[model samples]
Target: MIAASDLPEVIPLFPLPGALLLPRARLPLHVFEPRYLAMFDDVLKTPQRLIGMIQPQDGEDEGLAAIGCAGRVTGFSETGDGRYMITLSGISRFRLGERVEGFAPYIRAKVAWEDFARDLGAPEQDAEFRREPFLRLLERYFEARDLSTDWASLREAEDERLINSLSMLLPFDVSDKQALLEAPGLPERREILAALMEFALHAGDEGSEILQ
Candidate 1:
């Protein structure tokens, strides 16, 4: 429920590869690294309690991707072993800006929020989504990879929820997931998602234990 004016210009960043957080989706994370644990401590003090979830770009020395999503800390608990378990509910996507230089331990970045203003407005609906076909593809994709899922839950989810959740949870390539995250809208994202699954199924590696 954070207003656009309340969103901070600069926030703590977590540069994990292959992780994507789309608007309104929830991502759960386990914080064990000392620096991130410290980050959570500092972040909890802020009113927004937001963190930037970005992926490190591909290659040995590439920097962060151009876009990332900001998520608010919704659920938090501390483990006896000193690790922190937290859930981030995605708020909006932001365009990456310059990294703030200092001794804050974890990375912090200046982000611009204008391009993705739609993220904060309301949940989206994709009228073009055909559930039966998409679910058929998903079932084949899951079965091909020996993956198991709750069919009932998927059938019960809304279009945006199902597509966005799959985009985040799927084992697509980092680049592919990034494409899904960067998709201009839900319909476009759904297209990319379906294409990716179709490609994977026909990629001649159906027997592979895990998605590549």
Candidate 2:
């Protein structure tokens, strides 16, 4: 029941490549890095417990993408070896604003939440989603990559969950994941996702043809 106004103006940033966290989706992470462990330590002290899950720009590891999602630390535990097991439940996507300069080992930035205020609302729906056709495409794509998934689970999931989870779990390029994150709504995200899967399938077909 959190609102945009209740969100913190600034949040600690975790720059990870190929990781996508969309609104209403949960992402589990293993925190072993020293700096990130410190980041979680500080984040736990805050009331909101939000962390900006961002991607490092495609080519360079240092610069961050312009858009990123902020996820609340909804689940957390510490392992015996000082590592952390945490789950982030996405709240909203925000535009990266000014980077806060400080001595903190992790990155923190001032974020603008107005553009994605819808993310704070109820789960989104894609009325135009064609579940059967999309599942067919997904099967071909997964078969090409030799990947396996639970069919029953996918069939039972709502539109947003199915698409967003695939967008996060798929082995698409880092830029692809960022594009999915930045999509304005569920429909746009679905379009980009289907396109990406189709392209992968086509590319695989071409590769097979060449080897034949």
Candidate 3:
């Protein structure tokens, strides 16, 4: 476990609403918003093109969760006109140590990663309590959203792949998303995501037909 102070610090942050970056995940983001555009500029200037990806409470930026994950800029490029598109690769889980005033119109945070060493080789799979429920709920979620998911891809994904993909792409509320970010492990996160998906699916079905 690396110390928070020991982790390299990067200025400027990318705050995406209703999104969480879990460890070992790959997230692609389009940068067009002015604040994040400025963030890109700052990151382009240095080697520390890292950011703390945190989720704020629903409809409220002032109320942010204390825990977040650290993402390093893995692949980034610009079009001929200077529009920046980038991919964020999750490195480790981190907690917000303090609030930084302003780096580039976006909020900055002092962060410390979790002390425990996560063994990627072990896979950290939650076979019994998680797999089936998550898939079931995910199917229902897709139906409710009127989305046509590629089942072949979904079925082939491993635990980390499934969890990370769902965490980023799930259409849950900000608070719900934050909870997934703060969830302890694959088992817990999978369960919570299942429940949330079920809730959204049922609630939408009851109130209005999303398919219509």
Candidate 4:
């Protein structure tokens, strides 16, 4: 249970395009780049083992999107060859504030948590939302891609868990992924994901190549 006050005002930002971390979800990262390796080392020495996962607007030189989710280091392992394999547990989404100079090699940003306070706890389910349509679309999408998934596990997942997990796992375009990250709530995110999946399916049927 993380309180708003417990979150830091400034956090090291990891700007990887198409990578998203919704609250309560887990994101695994492999850190090999020198700058991010430095960032990882710095975080290891801190009491707040947190990092902000954001997507760059364009290339790494370009600006970052305004919103990103904060994740706390929950698992970590280091290779002898100088690399880090870590897992982060999502905390909450944050709106980026001004960038600030920080000790780490990576960029750090001041963030506002007011817009996503609800993310600290379990998401509220929408009684009116239908899961069948979304599930059907997902099945089709997986089949089209020739991806194998555990159906029993997916069926047993909670609504929020299912939606967020799929959103992170599916290979959507960068912009589409950002849209899902910025969605106001779980239901809205689910709707946006379904729409994106449908659009991709239609594009494939029209003989247009779909981006994985």
Candidate 5:
């Protein structure tokens, strides 16, 4: 039930390479690196201890992508070793505004949730858009992963949870994960997921399954 206006208008986000935060999911990050430890320290000083988690572009560890999800500091406990053990509960995805320059160690960017659409129920388009393809893609994904799934539970799950969980659980490459984070809407995201799952399965068709 939370909306864009209820959250902080501007948030300093940590741009992490090879990681993505999808709405309604928890992204746990270990902050031992000096840069990210500094990032956590900066969060403690702010009234709104929220940080957007965005994946860095290929070959670029410092620069951020145009889109990322806003994450609230749901879990924080310092370890005796001085590293931070923290968890981020996804709120809403935001658009990256600009990079903030400072000596805080980690690169940060301003983000706004205004343009981001909160993924809730199924889109207004059609049940068919979500139903048939989603089930098919999920079935293929589980089979390919050799995972034993509870079909009954999956059948009862809503579209948002199904899509978000799959995006996180699947062994997709970093660039593909970033694409999932940037997907326009639920329907569009689901469609792209269908394509990604199919490609992953077929990528092994040359008689060489890479994941093996």
Candidate 6:
């Protein structure tokens, strides 16, 4: 459990559009590119073992989105071919401050974590989230996409887990996923997820455009 004060001021930034890592969620990444392989190696030697997952803007070279989630490297393996398979466990969301240039081969950023201190603790199980509506919309979206999921496990997941998992796994556009990442809390994120799923079900093959 990382405390707010323990958060690092600088972290390596991995800019992957449409990939999100909410607090307490886990995201697996395959690191093969030389720059990122270097980043992975550097993180392994650091005590914090942290990385920031952010989304790069689609056009105009406007740099990264203001917010991103910081993940701790909880699982790691180095392949004989010099690749890395790693799992990052989300610690908290952070607001980007300024880009620092000295990291070499990869980007690093100054981050602010005060706004997301709440993420350092587990979400309350009894939080006021509308589960029935969310589940209904999720089912509809899944059916439309011809996607199969483990219903039993999804049904038993805690609210925070369910919402965060769906937000990360859903095929929404990069902007929509960022909305979920930047949402104020679990209930609001749940609401946005349901709304996005409902919209997707109605938009047919063009649903991603609606999310944009």
Report each candidate's C-alpha RMSD, comma-separated, in the order given. Answer: 2.9, 1.2, 3.6, 2.6, 3.5, 3.4
Q: Go through the candidates in order and give the clash count of each.
A: 0, 0, 0, 0, 0, 0
TM-score of 1: 0.94
Which pairs in model 1 have colliding backbones? none
Candidate number with the higher lDDT (4 or 6): 4
Best by TM-score: 2
Residue 168 displacement in candidate 6 (angstroms): 0.5
Candidate 3, residues 59-163, lDDT tens digits: the string is: 435666777777678898887876778887776766666667753477776765545246222457876655565677777788778878788898889977888
Which lDDT tens digits does candidate 6 get at residues 13-118? 9998888999999999999999999999899899889999999986423688999999999998989999989999999999999989883888888999989888
Instruction: Tell me the TM-score of model 6.
Output: 0.92
**Model 3: which ten-residue window has the lowest total lDDT?**
113-122
**Residue runs of model 4 more than 4 Å from their true location after superposition:** 208-212
Score candidate 3 by TM-score against the native: 0.81
lDDT (10s digit) by residue, model 5, range 31-79: 8987778778888787657787877765456466788887778888899
For model 6, where is the 10-residue window of minimal lDDT? 122-131
Q: Candidate 2, residues 20-135: lDDT per residue as tens digits?
A: 99999999999998999999999999999999999997443468999999999999888999999999999999999989999998899999999998998888999999999999
Worst 10 residues of 2 by lDDT: 55-64
Estimate candidate 4's RMSD in Å. Answer: 2.6
Q: Worst 10-residue stretch by lDDT in candidate 4? A: 203-212
Clashing pairs in model 4, backbone N/Cα/C closer than 3 A: none
